[model samples]
Target chain A: MSSCGVLVVAGTHGNEVNAPWLLQQWQANPDLIDAAGLAVQKVIGNPEALRRRCRYVDRDLNRCFLPEQLEQGASGLEFQRAGELLRLHGPSGEQPCAVAIDLHSTTAAMGNSLVVYGRRPADLALAALVQGALGLPIYLHEADAQQTGFLVESWPCGLVIEVGPVPQGLLNAGVVEQTRLGLESCLRALYQVRQELARLPDALVVHRHLGSRDLPKAENGEPQALVHPELQGRDWQNIASTQAMFRAADGTDRCEAWVGGEIPVFVNEAAYAEKSIAFSLTRREVWPVEPNWLLALKQLLAAA
Target chain B: MSSCGVLVVAGTHGNEVNAPWLLQQWQANPDLIDAAGLAVQKVIGNPEALRRRCRYVDRDLNRCFLPEQLEQGASGLEFQRAGELLRLHGPSGEQPCAVAIDLHSTTAAMGNSLVVYGRRPADLALAALVQGALGLPIYLHEADAQQTGFLVESWPCGLVIEVGPVPQGLLNAGVVEQTRLGLESCLRALYQVRQELARLPDALVVHRHLGSRDLPKAENGEPQALVHPELQGRDWQNIASTQAMFRAADGTDRCEAWVGGEIPVFVNEAAYAEKSIAFSLTRREVWPVEPNWLLALKQLLAAA
Candidate 1:
């Protein structure tokens, strides 16, 4: 008997059914998992709300996770159930290792992709495998102080597979299919980890976190178009601006691009807002703060 | 004579500080103007930076009118001048029944308190009565953006006074006495009917722009956090565990909080590192936007 690995699937908000449905389909198709030579457990998160096809019943299921709540044995019905299932089915003794994957969708109009945890070599190897197998861009995020309470942060080698938008009551068939393929790709990547995975892309360390900014505004008070810096090499596209650029900072009314160049990359969610437009990607060269600096600062201040 | 109702002042830069010091001290003396009841010109702005003691030269004399820049600019030369002078001069233009008080301090923190312009109601009022006032705040800053290459957002009712903090000097005893007595207490408020100033604060509006979060370690060694919520005010504060928050739609950490609350009040700056601490300020009632909304969303996405 092979030691089985664990797969974490969530974001079952009715408005976000693609992820759960995709996971269910993948679980039903044993060939997909069998081809990759891995065992899988499918946990349905947010069942009540997912049944209702709504974002949430009371509070957002996503935000209900907190450390105190976990310690006190507090959990939203869905989270509690999911946690219980994982604990009950700890990794199969036969499997030397296990991995989890969380599926999700974005509001922004973007290509199918995945976001991996910061520069952990294991995670990078996994990301490269998935990227190569699934043929999608992989965004790496280095976590920091201000960000807290995430499921992947507490799991080992978790991958957040982001499909495109899933409107209410409408399941994006393309997204569902792509998600299935992506999951299979993950299993394949994990299966090959013992051998070729070591040759995957070296995990690029992101030391200092430069902030994000929104794109410039047009003259008519509309959001200017934006393009992600990473997509530069890819044949990515963007919508056109409807109005001229207006300077919100000093009220300097002028055209959007004072100097002609490619639009800056959009970072974070709410890509439409001005603040999310991050122009420069400040790495260690510009800002040398360690990943733990902000956490340390907050702790020091809290102690003081 | 029509009593001088408004005063206009400008040019209190450290390089040109002769006017501000003289005016500040002059405005302080009660006996300078005729005893006959009439509106009097008051000492205007920036005695400290104009005194040219420290950190003044590097600061730009303009750009202080911006609300965000005002607080950060406080220690800078431009901030002191704007705060000190704009209070006295009011806005530009001479009203039939108004007087302008423009006061200034110089780089030397020396020089006579001179009333440079008095054409408008505010200006004429200061000229008529405050010419030889004891020690007064100098007011000057009437140069146009295009013409004078200075930032004098205030218009019509204007005054230009220059005093000390020039040629490497300290605030003279006379100027200090005048500023304390002439401008500090007496000029409690200044108003303009023509142009609308951004509303002042009856209560502090706390604006918290978002940033990244701390990644948490989970049992599976996978990083986890909450997914960023699309709705406003859904972001939480003081998230202890990094395992619960979600990466944002754009691949950054997520964050959230009430539009105006203790959190925004606590963190004041908007810019933050990708995985670092960041903040901003805004009116309590204002809808989430900018530096605040974008940042808050980023933090929520990263930490959610």
Candidate 2:
């Protein structure tokens, strides 16, 4: 089945400024990004939120793509925007999108990684290709009901390019350059897949999302402890029960809450405080790539 | 000379979450802050903005202390908040604050510094004493009409305790500890001043405010260039005109825009983008401390 094109969305959360700035640069100079003759459509995910330089207007736009969201009338700014975006770039919309790659930056020390929601064939193929090419880690985000409705879920094949250790609404050179490289790399892989010249790696490594943990809080929802200094920037590191994961108000270590052998991602993400998620735990896994996954990606890219 | 108690203000910009978190801990456990038996009243600068986890409600609350702001009827959330704060903690209010130490955190690479506005004798003396003890670099901000009405400027003897390189609304242990140590050091200085035993530094080192530089922009108020990779995190370092200070959209070095010998501070400060200030220039100077400054501090703290 043919599709519209590749939809490259940036600034889904307004406060993630680096990706949006790169998008603007790409818009101005089409040659800046090496799309390699593919029809790439660049878009700002949340223009209103970006204008205000905040994460969102009413609710997180990234979390607005659930099936149940569109069934109700739009009430908030993000709710309305989610509907408008679908009308313009949904699979069956005027601009009908074949695949989506959402660009995002985080306050956590998450470096550059691909966030693939669920185990979709095309998504796995694309993430594996990028990981093979760039040696970047894959975050297989699935089975967390508390974190659903990702913006990329609206497309046939989609994933998120998340880079970090940078602050919200601040442009950093390192972040911009990494984002530029990751995006161009994705486009190059897509072009190769279109011509059936793509090479799929034998094994894919991913940090499977297990659950999220909030900082210990009081009845009034104020955090009783903070992510311990030892664990603040130690994202993707394995921890043991003897390790200190949190710090009490008195500056003493709180180790009783440690999850042994559990790897943490998005450690102390600044925006996660709103969701009460100081960090989320994951389990590292290795899996063999399925042949059907590469076929799905080829089909999707041919449509693009 | 009997005066009111020392006022410690936090959350002045609301988005600066580290210092405020320290304040909450201090409030819960008064012993957390070493006030040295001197009366210290902790206050939140902007409660509404803090609740929203934003820098300000309407205008920047730090800029709401100008004389004309209070003369007019309060309109914006920050304006009303400024008035309310003064009514409760101002020099002539029921609490009658003596010295104000406004705590702030920034996105810039500035690490643990003091910001003294103008050369108020008391402010300078207090800053110099802290400098003698902590060896912190002081940024003497003055003669910049564009930047005024700081929250600490209202008190007789006050200066800003600024720590940074941390993201807004995020708490880091280094920032928290620096703020705590700086605030405690100032309190120790004041205690010495009360007993007329404070030893003001012979010569104070400061980065005098020279001017500010904004990234090249279009008429639409959008930045055309970013802070150069070589200069982004090099705050407080002297730059030569030959050095590349900004990068063009194509990643080429833009050296022609560099200002020679201009030490920049607040480089790439996230909030300053709203005011079009990418980085501010400064000139380092060493000045002998005047005896009158010590006398002024003594007179002010003798009543504390």
Candidate 3:
């Protein structure tokens, strides 16, 4: 069988410190990962930014992984880091790891979540395994493919482990512990599949990404209103189209009150303020998966 | 004697949108402050930052108001804005407003509180009045003189109205209402003082600032620890020095355990992470004040 291994990365944004802290904890105590037999390639995505305690020195490393961005030369620190990381682990790299897991924290009320780039079978099965193991709802980000430059997209079987409501540059121990638990559960699930003991549900619940909702802005693009108070901390709950999305400055009228029921994933994320995205909407779907077949089949095929 | 007008400023940090939203709401409906009969100069600090929904364009506007920094020429948008604001309502300005109230929201567990720069008599009296009237605790920030560049320091009886546990760039309605209530209470107390009807207790509780605690870092300065799980949301609560301050990544030992007690303000503050302050410690003190002397004398003197 092919060597079973996984590439685990944290601090891709530098500001999200809890994941890196958890990873460090894992390194300090190998028992934390005793159940996951896969060879782990632990990486700190942006050590420079982490040292300075900022989100990014130049551009977001999470968004600098595209082949075109890498070929265009190192325009910034993130670009350089992305190129180096790609050369070390990409499909053409000598190490050539297939399954990669990226850790992330959000400044929104999205508790613990799993984000899948698209509906690739291996990715879906892996997400299903994590979901079944941790009860974490998976967020399928498939709509905005054009804007995709996420690190997990570079690998064959890869996904992002997201946790938070914690702000950037700060670490919440609760979030840190949750992230560690999530990581452990993910690794355990992967180990189960590798040992031919995994059993994922035939139909896994997933939140399919539609589009992001931005707070209403004035002519100059300053926010004309804010997220409705009622919707502030309610992250995974479904909001009916009739429900108010934003409240105007006057607090008189509600803006962006849509007409369909959709759930918001990153509700009131502090970091997305710079990006003009209030939250992203999703529609729930039950995706079918081949469960234990993925890791075992892939391992056997690789060995052949 | 000064004219007893109040200059209320909000949105100093573009991300703290609730206070500014409340201010805008009040502006749209003036009757909300009909009782607080003071000439209100409702200024939105960092308008450019607010326009773009960010913390600041160049640097933190709140930290750019040092007298030396002001005289040293414009460093960025904040400096220019500070110069303009000073020109309009500063002590040396044409308007020369004496009582300035700066509104701020923190991404920490700091509940409703008042921040006094130093032990200024008038500032204390004002804080006492607010404490008595609104039942809000006062935070006496006397340490770290070099880092003092707050906007409220420009006026005679200036202070900051800080409220939170809320993240930046997101508005929590509960916090919004709380801020509004706090603002109204402050204004009412000021009006009472102007009318010689203000009453302050003899002993007021205050949190005396000692110093800030940063997360444990490695030789490279990246945080090697996180806030202790036990201390995550315990703001305003007394923490014994024997209690764990931070949990090392290894989860083996507590990193910064001490042997005293301190009440931590701004615990797990997301914004302060960039500044390397995990939390700020304060010693609780009961400050003595001359009961009801402030309003009686000030009003009598103004009448005379």
User: In lDDT terms, which candidate is top?
Assistant: 2
Instruction: Tell me the lDDT of model 1 at A55.
Output: 58
Model 3, A175-233: lDDT tens per residue? 88778777788777777776777787777898988889888776767566678877887
lDDT score, residue B297, model 3? 36
Backbone clash pairs for candidate 3 read B15-B169
- Between candidates 2 and 3, the one scoring higher on TM-score is 2
- Candidate 3's residue-wise lDDT over B26-133, tens digit each? 776687554366767789999989877668889888887778878888678998898888899876577666678899988777788899888767677778878887
lDDT of 2 at B26: 81
Q: Which ten residues in a row have the lowest lDDT in candidate 1 chain B?
A: B265-274
**In candidate 2, what are the lDDT values of residues B1-304, reduced to their tens digit?**
2353898989988899988889888877887877877777888888888988899988998998886868787589888888887888788777887799999998898889999999999999999999999999999999999998888887888989889889998978778888999999999988888877789879999999988888887687666778888887888887877887678666877665555567889999999988988888898999999999999887776654
Query: By TM-score, who's the top model here?
Result: 2
lDDT of each: 0.39, 0.85, 0.77
lDDT (Cα, tens digit) per residue for candidate 1, span A1-304: 1343546565545456667655554444445334355556566657777776545665554444454666577646745743554454423323222556777764333357676655554455566656556557655545533334445544445667766533233334455556666776776666565323323432332213343444454466433333322232121223234323322221223344322222222222321232233232323211222334223322222222
* Fnat for candidate 1 (0 to 1): 0.00
lDDT of 2 at B106: 89
| Error in Å for residue B120 of model 1 | 66
